[model samples]
Target: MSRVRHREAVFYDYFRQSTKIIVQAAELFDRIVGEWPSSKPLIPQMKELETRHDELTGSVIDELNRSFITPFDRGDIYSLISLLDGIVDGLEGVSARFDIYGVNEMVQSTRQMSGLILQCAHELDTLFEHFENFKRDGVVLEKVKRVSDLEDEGDLVYRRALGEVFSSSADPVHVLKWKSLLDKTEDALDNCKHVTNVVHSVVMKNA
Candidate 1:
């Protein structure tokens, strides 16, 4: 490949690698919520993924600064990587909260929300897989839409979860803890959709 093509490919490589970390983080979060205390051992693993994601984010920024040619708009590339990093950060934050807050049991809605997050993460992974072909392939748009749909599902689950937490819990502290956790979880899902939104814009601009 020519030098320009090779440089362009590097951005795509970063995107693919970033999405894989997001998926891994999401899966770990899902498992942690599903298994509760038994999954506490995996909390550290989520932090490791978050750290790896941070390093990947730094690598992308460094490459962007060093290279003259990029796969897409420089602003879009930066936004995409920043948003991807946010997803992992949000996951790590939520996972750490379980231990920090001394959460004894996992709620059903928490599990449900984590599952939705995992679904969104997988959808995002698939989206990036076809992103390099965004100009030629139609699947890119479809994947973007799928991520949006999952975000909407997450919103619904979050609302229901919040309502339950407020109504069912008598302790003010319990309600506050869950409310914070749900918000963070929802933010992760929103970040996934934000990445796709940026990708959609890049596709449209190129089209």
Candidate 2:
């Protein structure tokens, strides 16, 4: 195939892999929140997601190294790949605490945060599909914004839940657990934002 053809193919694979990474991270976040049973089982789920991405990254970089041509700058490709990877890494770090810290059940706010997290993941999956036909598909950009809005909503729920937790919960240990969980939820939303930011930035540069 031609160099330009090879380049597009490489970028396409990179973008698809990155999208998969983001979606899996989001799924893990949702699983932690939505499937909470005070058992800390979701930690494994999150770890598995990270492992899948690790495998994807190895495959991508190996392909990149072998290719005679690429679609974008090698640095840009590397940076973009790492940026998406960081989101998953950061999310897993946050989740790891659940098992290490022994945080079992969480509050209503935590549930709200998880619900929003799941929404972001769904939206992102849609956004990536739209990214494929971005010019031919104006809906992708709109959906990215929708994910942003959900994250914002998540922020509000997080704050209010924390306030309630502080006011109603008396156990110091409980407070600590809820506070940490709240922070983790917020960080996950931030992760979603990072994905959106990267996608929008790429669109600006290319479009």
Candidate 3:
């Protein structure tokens, strides 16, 4: 392969690695919420996932500077990487709260939001699958729309979950706890949609 093609391949692989990090973080967030064990192993799992994401982003930026021509715009690549990493930061922040805030008992509405986040995360797996193949098939745009739709659903669920959390609970402190958790969970979903937007932007510019 020519040097240019090889460099482009490296960039492609780096972007794919970053996308993997986004999906893994979202998935770990789901597991933490759904399978929140008393042992609290999920905390470390989430931290590790976010750490891997950080590593991938740093590598991408390093490669970006070393190469004169890139497959995609550096600005978009940086934005995409930052947004994907945002979910990890946000997810880990929420998961750590479980241990820090002494939340032993779980709330029903919070669990519901957790379940929704899992579903939303699962959708990301599929969306990124097509995205990883977009270079060959050009089908990621279609899947991005589907992911965006699920994120919209996530927003609706977030509102319902928050309403239940604030109105039904009597303890102000407990209300605050679940309220923050629910908001973070919803923010994770928003990050998923933002990932979709990044891909859509790439499609528009490249098409």
Candidate 4:
């Protein structure tokens, strides 16, 4: 095959691998939140996944630098990887806070957010599976909408979580700690949307 054809293949593989990394990180986030205190020991595992994602992102950047052509706009590829990386960072931040804040219990909102994050990740996985097909087919747009809808649900959970934090008479220090964790959870969810929006734009531009 020509070098041009090889470049296309390499680009596809890199994007797919990056998407897989995001999904794995999301699964780890779900497990960390689901198990909470018992899952404290898994923070290192989550950290490892974050590091792996960074490596994947770096690989994508290297590929972008060397390739004469890209599967998508180079800037879009960079932005998409950066936003997806942020999602993992957000997840790792939440896990780190559980230790830093000495949190012993998981709040209902945290669980809700965790579930939402997982759902968003799954939806993104679906979207990524169809990213290359978007120009020839329309089904990919539905996956984009699916992630966007999940983000809306996440926003509600985030607001309710914050409301509970401020309205309760919990210790001020406890309130601060919970607030930070909830914010991180919300940020992760939002990052999922940021990624989807970028995909949405790419699809529209190409479609």
Best by TM-score: 1
Lowest summed-lDDT stretch of 10 residues in model 3?
A: 124-133
Q: How do all the candidates rank in terms of TM-score, highest first? A: 1, 4, 3, 2
Q: Highest lDDT: give the candidate number.
A: 1
How much RMSD separates candidate 4 from the native structure?
1.4
User: Over the stretch 34-86, how does candidate 4's per-residue lDDT look in tens digits?
Assistant: 88889888899889988988898888778888887987788988898789889
What does candidate 1's lDDT look like per residue over 1-207, in tens digits?
Answer: 998999999999988999899899989999999999899899999999999999989988999999888877899999998999999999999999999999999878889889988998898888889888999988889989998998898899889989989999899999999899888889998998998899899998998
What is the lDDT, from 0 to 100, of the residue 185 in candidate 4?
A: 87
**lDDT, each prediction:** 0.91, 0.73, 0.73, 0.84
Model 2 — which ten-residue stretch has the worst lDDT? 33-42
> Judged by lDDT relative to the true structure, which candidate is superior, 2 or 4?
4
Residue 161 C-alpha lDDT in model 2: 91
lDDT of 3 at 109: 57
Off by over 4 Å in 4: none
The list of candidate 3 runs beyond 4 A from truth reads: 37-39, 119-126, 129-138
> Residue 157 deviation, candidate 4, in Å?
0.6
Clash totals, every prediction: 0, 0, 0, 0
As for TM-score, the candidate ahead, 3 or 4, is 4
